[model samples]
Target chain A: MRPALRPIVTLAPLAIVLLGLFGGGLLLGLLQSVGLFALTGSDAFTLSHYRALLNDREFLVSLALSVWVASLATAVSLLLGVTMATALHYGSFVGASRTRWQRTLLQVPLAMPHLSLALVVLHLLSPSGMLSRVAYALGLAPEPSAFPVLVQDAASVGILLAYVWKEAPFLAVVALTMLTRVSRDFDDAARTLGATRWQMWRRVHLPLVAPGLVSASLAVFAYVFGAYEVPLLLGRTYPAMLGVLAERRFSSVDLIDRPAALALALAMSLIAAMLVWVYLRLARQLVGERPVLF
Target chain B: MTSDSASPVILRGVSAAYGDTPVLRKVSLEIDAGELVALLGPSGCGKTTALKVIAGLLAPSEGEVYFGAENVTPLPAERRRAPMVFQKALLFPHLTVAENVAFPLDVQRIPTHQKKLRVAEALALVRLGDFGARLPRELSGGQEQRVALARAIVSAPRVMLLDEPFSALDETLRGQLRLLVREVQQRLGITTVFVTHDQREAATMSSRIALVLDGGIAQVGPARDFFTKPESLAVARFFGWQVLHGANGNWLAFRAEQARLIAPGGDAPPEGWLVLPAKHLFTTDLGTQRLARLRLAAGDEVEVEGPLPYVAPDAAVALALDPGCIREFPADAPATARGW
Candidate 1:
């Protein structure tokens, strides 16, 4: 009943639930990846599945594809999101009530379910879909078949399109929060110091918002790197995203592939953690003493 | 580059409104080049609005602003070349002290070597030369404000607008920075407009003080003129005078320091001096002076400031007010009348 023990007692139940569910699952995943689980019919830990995955060309190709898709999507989304947020912030202050509604309308995509957004992209950008029909009608394409194969393309353009549409709004909302927190005095100071509007944004406003952008962009990158539904619906069959390949291998008819699937999942988690670490280090160097999430 | 080409700023009946609320109304004032003026007033009196009007941050709903002979009404803040230091330091959190000081030069696209040299000089002028590499959050409140001052002056601006730049600091630091600002303004000879609610700050820091009342300037002259001869009863009250009624029904006002304490039943003061009977209520010791609250026989209260060792509470005393220091306004005169 001591006062110092009160907070610990209050948090005990939540901690127990988290440790029981998350920590227990993580331990089980690690054991299964090392071939120590009951399904592997062995108590001895082994790295044979990981070794096989390292040499397997398909797994390596899937890993590279997931990295490429997530990196490109995150980078492009960050640029677009920061630009949109800055523009919205500047525009929203003019006719405050009307442009406030405009800012709210831009957040419609943030509420959308990822799978639903992926399906929407697939329906509109497919070779035989709405865009192709419009292109053919306008004589830009001779037929629906002449339109490029955007949906389920080998380069994952369709998946990238869906992700950018979904996650850019997420980053934009975060960026807008940062932009609004900056005081108007700083902007006035910059302007009075002879900075043009563009220079003020570039030198002062952008640096102020970079901390929030860097942290939020890392979240988007990690999410897209390990996300499942969008890539499965929009990606090609041969060089699939790691998430898609891992799920397929886990559910295969041959039970021996289960360990390899677990290992690949572990690898994805490791890479995401590494990416987060690298990002935090770079952000600290750039932002100087501001707390950056790892 | 000609010396006489720099325009003295002139505001010809400038007025501004926010939505339907009128903040400044038909306010006109002229400021000469290389002069430091303080817009002194209570909060919400449009002191800051006037400063912003001159800085081109706020466009007047009516009237025009001229810098020297050129109409600058349409110019934006970025084109005005007048930098401002805000009430708070408002140093950019992401930038180091050196970078913050160099911001104006960067905006001007001045060469890097000159920018570095000027930044160093500005920092040194603020006595913060050793702290330039530190981030703003790493510095103390006073240091942050010093850095902001450095940043404001580093561009060698044509004019400087200071909006209560030292209001956030302690009294001692405020006085020190006030002196620093005065020295820098005199040394650089940049036309400066400082906005402050503190009368003492306005008096100490500015060559002339403009007393703002009810959205317009009531009087503009040397700081001594405001204390010695306020033009109206409102200006007297704004200067913290406790107005007392004379025998003839004229309103009499004098500063706390203008009254001299006399022995109870002592010989009368010199000719033309008004001797008032009072009872001491209480006194507070300020380091160099004692401030006593005294009530006259007619139930009017007045504050008196004099040398230390104040009389005991509830003791009978006499206050001799110099007729020269007493400003009288006729009973029927309006608050805006020019009462001397």
Candidate 2:
């Protein structure tokens, strides 16, 4: 084989599997959503499914809910993750054994599956769950019924909490990796330049960690936006997350609603792609024109 | 821009450790106001740690640091205002050169116009006036270090710390930067503490050299004193002095250049010169001069450098030492004499 072609040939098998599985499924979904490749009806391309979604208030409400949940979850996770990583990095002076224990504890959340985490969130935040019971037992509340509705509510607080709990540790690991790669001398330099602790965070730590944080946040946001099981287990019935709504339509008894479901899935993908673009642009500004995405 | 007249820095009986491993042990030194002192030592000898202690970047386990009359041991690095230039340029990669130079002022929240003026003045001081708009990545290694220097002094710090700031550069660039640093230090008259392992760099750049050995200061004095009057055998050895044991627990030390070789069976009638018998082991050509290696009768190996002495291998020779060049230390003397 030619030298230049060797790398291509070596990579071809993995590329084939990824493109065939993911790309092929996406292409099929796109065709079905546009009214072509229909399983039962005439396979003719049309935009009626997407047009119907634009006019449907239920779909619009679900879309807005998904955006709201995902945005809040991602923003809170990123903030907490960056703060946690910075604390761990600087707190290393507290002694190696304690720092090691702290780091190990942070990874405990990352080890559990998201489904298990969502269930855990349900058990902890439900009206009659451990927290409400404890609150009542401590005389902070009159009873479990008096506890605020957190799960299966219009606010989607349960789903957002689950996402943050599951994803913040992952983001912290990402940001920590970048933090360790940055030399401690930079911090020393900043300190010697008379930067207070807050100024160090704003000027040095933030910019240095932004690229990794942004990349990891894009992943978290996209995953939370389109995830199905957590929202299904925790979200409100009246106005569901986009993922739950799409799954409901796809699984409905009527076959005619399939195109609308596929269209909703495609819309979720479009929104994720647009968000990734915006994140990449913001990452460029934060990291000083260094190519972050590529 | 002139800083507040420089404050004398003093580290009194400071000791520090990393985990359980002690890095600096009761190291003490004092610098006059406007004096430049180099903390000189071999690698891992705690010179840099001492510099960090003075800069307030590392808290000493014991003892106090003072800036003039103020006890600053409790102050953090940010409040100390002793800016340090590191071995690597360590310029903030995200900021342009001007922003990096202006960073100290920005941290102090100096007004915009004064910040701009000082940044420009610092860049010009480092001879990088036109390069302010470029990022750190765009500058060469030497230029990056220059920018780091500019950033260090831009705040008009009363004292500066430099930790091997030019060791990464090539010899030519190192020489250029050494001169540049010395020039700027003298021009500003800031009390500066520089850390370095290179003797020549320390000698060339610092008004005084503090020789650190193990975790303690061996000796601190004028550069010429280190060469002529080392206080201990260890200090003499560190400066490449050939030491010989003498009677009554005395140690004689002299440099390689101070020894002269005389032909075997030659005259030995010098009044004050000390002479030892030796065998020529070999000769090494050092371009400008040739070094003749010899083993003395007492089993100590020493090298003498001069125009090629006609001594064949295994040929017996007499080594004569100038009494003026010899320093004596007691055999029981500690490795570091602290009071010196």
Candidate 3:
């Protein structure tokens, strides 16, 4: 007979804790779908609710809007992010006081909360906001109304602005992190080969960090999709994003629409899952398997 | 262009310090073109920092560096055209082996056709003609480092800095890579500075060596002279154990090879030179010569080099000392060693 094992006995508590967290999340999702031991037993699984979700146009519009806003925001943020990171990384901007202040200010945006960041955007870009106020004082505008429609305006411009304010910093941070891993040796090699700083970045640094930027942008895309509060406060009605639509569905007073709310949530979940999968798949295709581990 | 590639590259009144922490003090040397110079010392002897300054990756706190007759002291690393290979195989992992070798040319925007030809030539010179298509990960560690060398010389840089490039490899692999680097450096006539902490590495690779101690060059001379006869007491002890005597208020020093194992009970040691065995014997493997350690009664262990085949362990072997290896040091000197 085997002896009572000391190591396994000692490891029992850790094993229970690990499985409780890792396995419990998916199990809870499965149980809620099946109405197993839920607080409300009446909401049982049904095929019609799921079918109605597929047929609903409002849910579909919100889903499409999520993708549209996320992709646009991610693309614009990457362009801005790459520009800002490169300016700071290789530039002797450290010599100028204003550039130093700007560099310090760059870290501030990443630390600020998204809601706080949205407030910052609203304060600075609203028709009656800081820029408009300055314009009013300069006689550029007859009144605040003379300013262009910015807050809750069509084209999702205000919402996209707010999203980018938060997301661009995140992208810049990731870009800087990736840039740090580019070994000086490779750059030195490039220089000896007679590469200018810009040329070195184009040939060496860009290829090395491209994969990380792709993944960072994908993450920003996902973050933009799931942001419920940002669009709820800042988004337009004509092209309502998915987060705003999902919030509306969950808060509807009609009792019969509850199933449709669950269906909308599940639909949003499915789209997000697909985007994430496709993003990872395409990144792997482009970058291949081997690069610097750091 | 350098006015004369035949003249030596010189460092004048060179001193480097970081935040009042002195790293190199009044250190200077002249390295000739087509010469292989080794900066030999234990780590933190400012060997790597010196190489970096020469490569222009670092601007020395003081003094100027000259390539032949022209002063290129203030130039950026790229403008200086000094390529360096790091201890780790620091290849551009993102690029394929061929693309990696082609990187310098691509950066310079060489015509696509010429870039390919240079890459082929560089890879062929390094005996890696067929590895161009493979990524660095596909190749072994030594192969990856060889690709780095190919990239370095593809542009035909005037100076090469090797910061212990092969130090990470095993002994056998290191020897092979050493030969490869030596042959290629010779063929290209690139003035090379190799920084290594291992005495054996410094001894084997360099045409000449500069010994560094306490952030300064202690001695600089031909490798054979430095190895066989180290002048300073610190340099003497750094090589191995030696016996010292006082004559005319100066300290006279000779190697452990002068002392032999006679019958144990001793009133005093023999006239030529004497050392009593301590407690340890470290077996060292030098390429051409194998050496055994003898611990003297003074608790100092000195290495005795002879025609060694394989001696029995702990057997008392008589040493035949060559008095020519004996060196004398200044009596008032301080203690400092720059060795393995």
Best by lDDT: 2
User: Lowest-scoring 10 consecutive residues by lDDT in candidate 2 chain B?
Assistant: B331-340
Better of 1 and 3 by DockQ: 1
> Which 10 residues in a row give candidate 1 chain B its minimum summed lDDT?
B1-10
Worst 10 residues of 1 chain A by lDDT: A285-294
Docking class of 3: acceptable
Off by over 4 Å in 3: A1-68, A83-116, A128-140, A181-195, A225-228, A245-294, B1-8, B241-243, B258-323, B335-340
* DockQ metric for all predictions: 0.77, 0.81, 0.46
By summed lDDT, which 10 consecutive residues of candidate 3 chain A come out lowest? A30-39
**1 or 2, which is superior by lDDT?**
2
Top model number, TM-score:
2
Docking quality level of the chain pair in candidate 2: high
Q: Report the backbone clash tally of model 3.
A: 7
Which residue pairs show collisions in model 3? Answer: B276-B296, B276-B297, B277-B295, B277-B296, B277-B297, B278-B295, B278-B296
For the predicted complex of model 1, DockQ is: 0.77
Ranking by DockQ: 2, 1, 3
lDDT of 1 by residue, A1-294 (tens): 999999999999999999999999888988988978748486677888888887989989998998899999999899888888988888876766856775787799989999999999989999878999999999999998899999899878999999999988888899898898999788888888888889989888888888778888888989999989999999999899989988998898877777778898898899888977887787778765454564
TM-score-wise, the better of 2 and 3 is 2
Write candidate 2's Cα lDDT for B100-192 as tens digits. 999999999999999999999999989999998998989999999999999999887879999999888899999999999899888888889
**RMSD, one per candidate, in order:** 3.5, 2.6, 6.7
The per-residue C-alpha lDDT of model 3 at residue A66 equals: 81
Cα misplacement distance, residue B244 of candidate 3 (Å): 0.8
